[model samples]
Target: MTMGTAGLETQPSATTYELGDLVAQAWSGKVHVPHFQRDFRWTTKDVLRLFDSIVKGYPIGNLLLWVRRTPERSFTLGSLRIDAPAYEEAFWVVDGQQRITSLANALHPEGHLHDPFAVYYDLAERKFISQPKTREPQHVALPILFDLKRLLAWFRTEGEAVLHLFDEADRVATALRQYKVPAYLVRQDDLDVLTDIFDRMNNYGKRLNRAEIFSALYAGPEDGAEERLNLSRIADRLASRTGFGTIDTDTILASILARRGPDPARDIRNEFTSAGRRTAPEFENEDQDTAYAEGEEALVRAISFLQNEAGVPHLSLLAYRALLVVLTRFFAHFPAPEANTLRLLRRLYWRVAVSGPAVFKGSFTQVSRVLCARIRKGDEHGSVRGLMDTMAEAPRSLPTVERFRTNEAAAKIILSAWWSLRPRSLMTGEPYDAQDLSTLLGDQKTAATAAHVIFPRGLTAQQQLYAGNRIFLPTATDPVSEIPVMLMRQPIDLDDRTWDAVLASHVMNREATGLLADGDREGFLHIRQELIAGQLSDFLDRMAEWDYEDTPSLETLDFDNLDELEGGDDHSL
Candidate 1:
């Protein structure tokens, strides 16, 4: 393949080497990974697949290396922490980091490497399997078996029963040492060109994304005389603090750019030069130190508003990344608004979320610019008005019961908003505390305990069930079987005391519960939809005070005749 030199193009030289020799080169400071490369991302299963391929005499892949004279820095190999000293010349792996890392970690695991690829060979099954920290019988750790003396000692003590397996172990060791991987050595000095080449080569596989490339361009030393800022690590830290899960690097970069002038939604790579600094006057004159600090503070405030006011308690429930950028810019412009203004802003936030695709129909950049301009002008009313105006054009209707089951964003927003009203559990009649509900929603395992269907799915056909059919029941309430049992009995079979208990325990209004008690499938759906739509309508109205005539309202479906309802055939109670 053609390689680019200092303003010149040339062909790279090729060579072949045994696997053991490559491992030795990495251990002895003759090879290293450059700072621009991504961190090791392969899992234990991937490592096992590599070893299995090697044992089967399959061609793994070729290694692309840049031969540099007078290396600029010292480095470590994989998770082994095998420090390689700076040398006059060293080969830096550019394209085959995953393979090289897997080899180094698997071969030299005895160095107590804190790697994820801990594996062993099961002698009984004759296969490679991922092993835990603790040892098990009939299993030989790959790292320990790399050494002949250790292998012989282990066999003498542990392999006496499976003496016939000695030949298999010897074969595995031979294959690892004798396997030759093709290599290409190129001499290139331009960092930008090297990054381009790396990107192009990886396109055939799991190529690097824009965020990863941006991170590589801006990443600083992990350990140095002066602590340098790493955007990736900073995003991770923010997510941990907010319990928002892992935030994408692009979102973090956009937030930082938003603090400065210009739309953060545009291509970020254009903002940075090859040297990794702002190129335009709008950004060049801005102090990066202040921008980063303000960006972080504004993001925290935005997340707080989302959790406390908007009912979006976690990051997974956040439907759009564009929303974060808009909120970040607003908070950056207006660090703290008055109490009434803050209340208006919170209302606007939930309205936008519930409005769905309408609020984000046009260019996100334009939306961010508009909102930020109003906030900067200290026009809180205008800011809220502008956002609502955009949302007004979209068809704003309460989602159907079917939509809640299928659409994740809608379900999260609706449930979170409803949960915020302190609705009582249908089973226990106890008011749900916001903190406990938020914790349960944030965790996957506990989320199921927060809500369930009043009529068990087994009793009704698919068409009869929808989001309105579900209720938020506290975990401490009566068993789930209790409700189904009462519903299964005839109306006369349930005494007045039991009926009162059922009505009080469920969050449904009296009209909706009466339909359920009478086994009127069509009436129950109509009443439940009206009840939920009414709740949503009231919630939106309470968010802010406005005089706009185009404010969207939830349409309550009414049916004069039960047979006229759609999907009535399969919805018999």
Candidate 2:
């Protein structure tokens, strides 16, 4: 009997029975079975919960079975074997794989069922083991058996007179053979109905990908059309390699886009959308499909190169995000960046992955800006290599004065090169372009650099200090506030006049051109304020973006001892 929507009389009819009875009847071939269904995959918990429901007399659910009677319709049930006489030649199960598997294990003889050990019990620990066999390998549970000898022995001894209660089991089993499990039994001739029904059912718990639903709907023939060809290939590959039996491409795409942590195989269903009717939708457009395909392909390629070519050990979300951005840029601009570009990209990639995503986003934009500057500006004084060498350790610990110096060095080298080439400030975003670089680098050119003006731009410590000290000199307790304070405990033996020049240079390099309006001094201070504010805001945005729980403090990080591994290693996988 096809339990079509019209055939299903929704009069709130109720039936009560233990799962064991249903399994016995289904096994006996007295039920309708869907040809496309797989066998029971119920975990121990699922089994236990079924038993608990029976013990507590709770309503489990209706059993959905398909009624058929053709030898051609019989399919090899997964992890199950029928030993008893055939109850029905064509009957197969449509739903309740877990429930049926559980009941079989609880009542059948050990070693008689396909998977003899279906449930696990930890003898030493005296507790039921958890799901995912890895968590409880030492445990042993029940097995499905149909040996009449064993059943008789059990009834005579362990089962006792209580075994007579099976009359009730038979009654329930008989009823289930006729009861509907609330499914639409489709015919080979009506695939559209099956496709629609499958999509609706699948989208209920989590959203399915447009590609996936399309694949499932049109999966009947393997003759590949270009549009549907890749979908099946990808789906088949993912299912074979990953065993994500109940998921589709949409879930995978969402995971790639938003999931955190080091495990690429981690579930990302909840990351993209909430649980509701909106979870499953037919993919909206060609552009989105293209983006998803491109993104997945890019990620796959990155993992392949990092793991196989570069020998990187571990893949982290931080590194992946940065790499994604870099790849996106490459795909957009260079189309095919050089191997050297990949090497440089990898150098920074590992740094971010190990540092975690929160730190990566916080530092990436500034780092990218610094990188662009260096590439634009040639190494006139061997500063570019020196900067990369020094900044290598910045990813391990919080930013410190020394690390900041490295950043400053890179900035100086890059900015100098940029200015040397395009003398116009990228920061000011002004349209004015200068023709001569010499005019900017003329004698006493950096006498008003942003750094010189920005460092301790206010009045000297001695000027506001103790009753007798000079305005520029450090008092006994206030040495930290002196000009030498910026020297980081290093003594500068320069005369007052030279000290003034040094301060001026620092301010000139770091100061914004906007701050130069009322003379270099005020402009220097104003630029420092702008840079500091901008950096701080970017940092906060990273924290929010990563959803970091604890704010990480800035300190010097040691990249040397980070157990760093390259991209080509198997560990990268």
Candidate 3:
């Protein structure tokens, strides 16, 4: 039935919907998820758990929606595409987006390969697994199992091994057919009422993140577009601009807030217009549009400092985002700092990263706040000195290659330092550009996409997992497995210089290659690992500048010698 907005003062109407029908409605455009809801964040494990819950008669949750006039448009839920005609009143989903999108896309026949929704049921195991590269009769695609005609056809094609499970397949199909979702259709007229409900619902137990809360409050009118000032999009732009994946919505919000004041945890609901909010002098009395623009500008400058000057190549490689937040404030205050101050600030960055969390004498949050407080307007020199003094007081811990991991801050420091040596693509022999690296990694949350530890079956489990086996090369094939093979025969095209340069890019000398050629894989790793440890140690020490004394910044020094002081022949002093 087509429900209209009625009884605005009364409670929201409730109904139960069949799972398959809800998917069909979403696909056909009768139902739509609003933009303020979080994106599809469920991993395949989450999806599998959800399906398992359903099959085991567990309750997922209720879906809350609003009934309103929706315009004709095209939208996507995961990989499923929809084209909807204008309706006087359509169901606009306010919550349960992740579950709905998961069901819609996972059960859709057109769900793309490698999507979290690509799932199958193993009839023999009676369990769900990620879709395999090769298909077997016992493995039933979820989409096909949910359809009556397809299930009938699937039975006819399979041999007697699958015939015995007909009752189980029918039972699974019936479970899906009977599974119902409790839904609420709000008929509220005022947009504030809907936002209030969303706010109240999410605030009950802090269900939503601060970024999502800010986004929901600022999301435009019901008939307008979704999430006008989405911080996640801001993060995406910064990530793309610098090839630094995932600035993170919380960090992006904090960056914008840092441009306003030192307190990132300040009330974001009144960020722009509230007189209570603290803002930088030049940024005062601005609208959200201006705040977003200028704040993004500050963030870009900070990210560029890390990428260009600080030797950190990727966002994932940065040891701490709290450090990035502090730097964002510094750059926002002094867009082009004096040369000496910039150098000192870069040194401070290296010191903090190499020292890891131990760089903070207090709690990380307290230290971050203290650092942000140091960066005030018109005091660039003082800021640098304060930051250096604060970090230097804390002890240092240089990174080691042992227990190499993608997510650990120490490992990130090691990877960034390795890239400082300019790891090149083995195929092209060209330096691995940040842009190309970002494209290859593509918003991967960890360094696993960029680094690899090869494990040939010849090695023991302990030997296979050794950090020495790790390589930081960018190639389609693993360098450890392929490099020896490539060097086995004489190169038809390239000369020794080119090949030598290629090996150097990977931090491997011919001696290492000779070990690799002799099938002594451990020996090859040992040579490369020893070289990496020395280089990383030197890079960290040089960047930290522990021995350098802090002097007045360049602009602060008196440069008014009138060109006579340095001229040897000038008699006029």
Candidate 4:
């Protein structure tokens, strides 16, 4: 350690030391970890990589330690090689899961480092063996052996050659003990500083998902029958499940409101949590449960609509807000106490399919108004029934309703419509076409010659990494840190020039790019003629056929005969 400009004293950390030293100190009763810490489960490969880097003199990461005044009861660590007390007072390992485990394995007296270390070598006889007598038994590296007596005993029997082996092991251990991986030791008791440091460091550089980190921190219980009564616990679980990454806090609040509807508890929770939540600065305890229930109900309704009626294959981060809107309307007018009404929901779904995502996203206000209108007439909202029936009867396009695009309002209507119908092919402009995955992927390369290349500007690595196969905003650029490795999931043969040319062609045909205006999601479709032609050619050349278990059928729905459609199905309302 060295002092900075402030004259704060620090030790001159050695770059070389004995692993036995750390082991001895630990066995002497220095507990370095807490009970909540995960156990040592590193496989041979994981350990080997650490050693390999050490051999090359690469600096392994530092051990983050929370120093405490007193140590607690101890246990043997890492294959029972070393014993140490568990840290009980007020300290924990905030980072460095890998390096510390490696160190623990290397120096413990009881540890066996001689199981097997995997390395490939050509054999005189044409076969691979882990060692002289061993067949490849999950070739593992023996633990780092550092006991002086053990080294002496083996050396006396095996000669100077054995000494050389011990010497090499000692040297590596020495380097590990002395090598300093950067450690951030925080003093005083402030969880905020620790969390902020952990979050900012990881976010700015390593970049774990916000939900992932939150899951680690606040994760408590599942939102099943047993856990639903606890508001905080239920919210945490819902946030972990439905909330995508950074938007978790908001999603948790939204989920609650979706279940219970408008209430001031949201405001109080918001005060304790953070901004962007549906909570206010204060909420009355008496009203907390009602608000929480409303939120939860909203989420359930939205999820149902998306899964059953909208035919959304999977939920996406972008679609969350839209779903929230849908749930608001569903809970407002229907007596969902029984499964019978859900059956009728199927008939209502057809209207969703015909409406298209664009219309639903845009017409949220009108949908809510309609829901309210129907609620006044009867618990069985006939307005929704009428709307679906009317939309189904036509050689004409789906009816477009205009309304405010308030996030919540929009989500409710969109979800309701989505629940009522099966999703059609966005490409073919028809009901989903029956095709095998092989056929889909194979022809996908070239089958749709007329298909447009969406996201022509190019997809960023972060977007591609998280978005899976979904099309994203074309203008998005991946951060410099995430590239090549992140973007390798798809074929990379198409060059930038080709992408631009394809996009140019699509622009020419569609007039002004036809990019999603509100979402800034323009040029997402790959629609240029030449590009489609090239894709088709590739499909024909490289596509392979795969055997699938069962093919799904598209249901023919008659919205007018609601009772017939809703009543006959086992799962129907």
Candidate 1: tens digits of C-alpha lDDT, residues 458-536: 3346534466766665455446556544443425645556555554344355566566667776677677666676666
For residues 1-573, write the lDDT of model 2, one tens digit per residue: 123453222322244443445556645545432322322455556666665455444666644433333332232233445443444333334345455555554544432243432443333343333333463333333331133344345446545544544443333333323333332232232444444455555556444444444345444421233344234345345333322222234434332332121222223332223343223322223233453465455445544444433332122102233344333323322334445444444444444433443542455444432332332122212222332342454444322111122123222222222222222212121221221222222222121222221234454543222111111110122233433334322124555454434333222232343334335543444454344334423432332223222211222234554535433365757
Off by over 4 Å in 2: 1-21, 24-41, 64-78, 81-95, 104-117, 120-149, 155-189, 205-300, 308-311, 314-337, 344-573
Ranking according to TM-score, highest score first: 3, 1, 4, 2
Greater-TM-score candidate between 2 and 4: 4
C-alpha lDDT values of all predictions: 0.63, 0.36, 0.76, 0.37
Count the clashes in each prediction. 2, 50, 0, 65
Give the Å shift of residue 77 in candidate 4.
Answer: 7.7
lDDT of 3 by residue, 1-573 (tens): 123454359788899998988888887887887777767788999988888888888998999989888889988878777889998888888888888888888887897354799988888788888888897778888888899898888788862468888888888878876799999989876775677678768866698887787777767664546444467778877776778788778778777777778776667656655545445434667777677777888988998888888888777788888888889889988999877877888888888777755555566666567788777677888778888878757554567676677898777887888788788655556677776667767677777866876544677666665556666765554354664466444365666787687777666778887887888888877887787777777887778877778677556656666455667576656
Which parts of model 4 have CA positions greater than 4 angstroms off? 1-46, 69-91, 105-141, 151-174, 215-271, 274-341, 344-573
lDDT of 4 by residue, 1-573 (tens): 122343213432323224445445544555254332333456656665665575557876655555445534445455443334554443345555445555554444344333223322111222222334553322222332234444455446533343434545455435545544555555534444444445445556754543334433332221232333334444444444433112233444434433333331222223334445544322234244455555555555555554543443223212334234434445544535234344444333433333444443445434433322332224344434543443343232322222212133232233223322322222221332212211232312121211112333355543332111121111212232332222222225545454333333222223223323323332322232233334323322221111111111223344558877667785754
Q: What is the TM-score of each candidate against the true structure?
A: 0.71, 0.38, 0.84, 0.40
Model 3 residue 514 CA deviation (Å) reads: 5.3
Residue 476 deviation, candidate 3, in Å? 2.7
TM-score of 1: 0.71
